[model samples]
Target: MSAVDEIVREWTAQLLDSGSVAALVAGLVALALVLHRATWLPLRGVVTIAHEGGHALVALLSGRTLNGIRLHSDTSGLTVSTGKPTGPGMVLTLFAGYPAVSLLGLGGAWLVTVDLAHVMLWGCVALLAAVLLAVRNVYGVLSVLVTGGAVFAVSWFATPAWQALCGALLCWFLLFGGVRPIAELRRKRSHGRAASSDADQLARLTGVPAGLWLACWFLIALVCLVFGARWLLLMPQL
Candidate 1:
């Protein structure tokens, strides 16, 4: 068979066999990385990227002028936009960050469930590329470039098995890792810390308690995790 035909055959086989040993091992490794603080430090930037991208996306969509995004070393990001100081646009822009990561994770896992792992990886690359355009800080630029480059490398050069492995790992990371920030938000709220957090901002904007916002964010993350686990793990076993 021709090279193109052989590659297509290989991809088809990989798609049909999501229960492969490689996928299982990759998932375990991903879980370990997400659970360990040392590994989480570097990878946390991925969540931040999604969070800030969400803010930027909503800002532009809501008739706001996009300022820029800043990704800090502490795994925190800031997105600055100019718009009506109060209204649906402001509230939506503020509301976008936490759920963005969870939704991205859930979407990625769903793609893998449907055997579209490669599509998810390249889609991430596309997302990072789009986010990079709004990054105004050195760290933000580097974070997007490095993450996008790694994903691009895998999508472009890796074997189908390895690509699938990378895709699964990323899906798991996005699925599980997205929940951490919500936990952190809860901790902050309990300890009366970070009064300027997103939850706090939401509180001030809507006159709702920050704790309620935290609970809402936690619920969204938990729901995403449950559904993602079902799709990624339980469905495959059945």
Candidate 2:
């Protein structure tokens, strides 16, 4: 067999083999991060990337022109686009932010169950690379680069066991981290702040109440978490 064929055969084996990594341990570690503010605060940057990426995705898919994206130090992000202010497309673009993390978490969990933990990490690196392109601020650029580098390092340098562990931790983080921001948003909205939140913007665009939209976001996250945990833990044949 040629060298190329040997490489393909090896890679194919890696993709099919489920490395030994306990999902529960990873989930517990991620839960701790969510509970501890100091750790969770800095890590929120990853969530911001997913949030803004969701907006950017819907904008482009909706045929709107994306202006740029900005990731702030405070774990907030902005995605600007040009299009009709009031329509399903604009509403969807605005609405995608809060649910994005959970959606990603769910997807990652599915990949792991199918013995594709390695593929999941590489997918994250690719995603961050794309997000980096639309970043307009220096901070945003640095944020994406640092994040992508970390994932790339783990995916490339780590042993398969360690990579599987990290992948589980990542999915768990997304699953748990998905709910915290909505809680914060609820607090801000209760205090009459965050008038510009996605829920609020959605309210302005549509006739639905912001509170109702917030409820929907919460439900989506919760549902994703429940099902994602099942798949990650059970490792069911798919």
Candidate 3:
């Protein structure tokens, strides 16, 4: 077979490969740690990367010039853009964070379905590199470097099986972990704090209630979580 044909064949094999129960178990363990507040300390930055990346993507799509994206040590991120402050673009940019991580995980699952786990890892490397160019602060730079480096390491040194396992676990974590922040946002809103959250910001910009935005996000995240579980795990069984 030609090179392209060979790649397609390999991809087909991976897509059809019924992953072992051990692999599923591994992902479950990782999911637990990724979801746990205390154990998620180190991996929190990855979630922030997805959050800020979502904002950056919508900003670009909405005809804004992305000024930069910052990832903080505290797992908070900011994406700055220059554009019309009031419009669909701004609303989408604001709405991107909560859904971004789950969407990203869904995208990753799609890649695995197409037998492109290595592509997923390499894609992370490339994206982090781009984010690095826009990073202005020490923490942001460090965060991008660490994440990019680890992914690059796996892509370069790990076996295919290891890469596949890591990819699945990462996808599961993002799908499951995406809801935690939304719950926290709801709690903060209920407590009369977090007056400056994205949902509240959207409410100010669009005249909708912040709770409604939160509710919408909650529903979307829950859906993504359920569908992602089936797509990444259960579907392969059938």
RMSD of each: 5.7, 7.4, 7.5
Q: What clash count does candidate 1 reach?
A: 0
For 156-175, candidate 1 gives per-residue lDDT tens digits of 99875566667777877877
lDDT value, residue 181 of candidate 3: 81
Residues 163-206, model 2: lDDT tens digits:
76678789999989989999999999999999999998898888
TM-score of 3: 0.87
Ranking by TM-score: 2, 1, 3
Each candidate's number of clashing pairs is: 0, 0, 0
lDDT of 2: 0.88
lDDT (10s digit) by residue, model 3, range 1-238: 6999999888656643656453466468767877677888778788888888888888898899999987778788888899899999999999998899888888887776456889988987888887788887899998889889888998999877668767777788788778888888899888998989999999999999998999898888888877766666643421
As for candidate 3, its clashing pairs are none
Task: Assess every candidate by TM-score.
Answer: 0.87, 0.89, 0.87
Global Cα lDDT for candidate 1: 0.83
Error (Å) of candidate 1 at residue 231 is 1.4
Q: Local error of candidate 2 at 232, Å?
A: 1.1
In TM-score terms, candidate 1 sits at 0.87
For each candidate, the alpha-carbon lDDT, in order, equals: 0.83, 0.88, 0.81
Q: Rank the candidates by lDDT, best first.
A: 2, 1, 3
Q: After superposition, how far is residue 141 of candidate 3 from its true place, in Å?
A: 0.6
Q: Candidate 3 at residue 137, lDDT?
A: 85
Worst 10 residues of 1 by lDDT: 229-238
Candidate 3 global CA lDDT score:
0.81
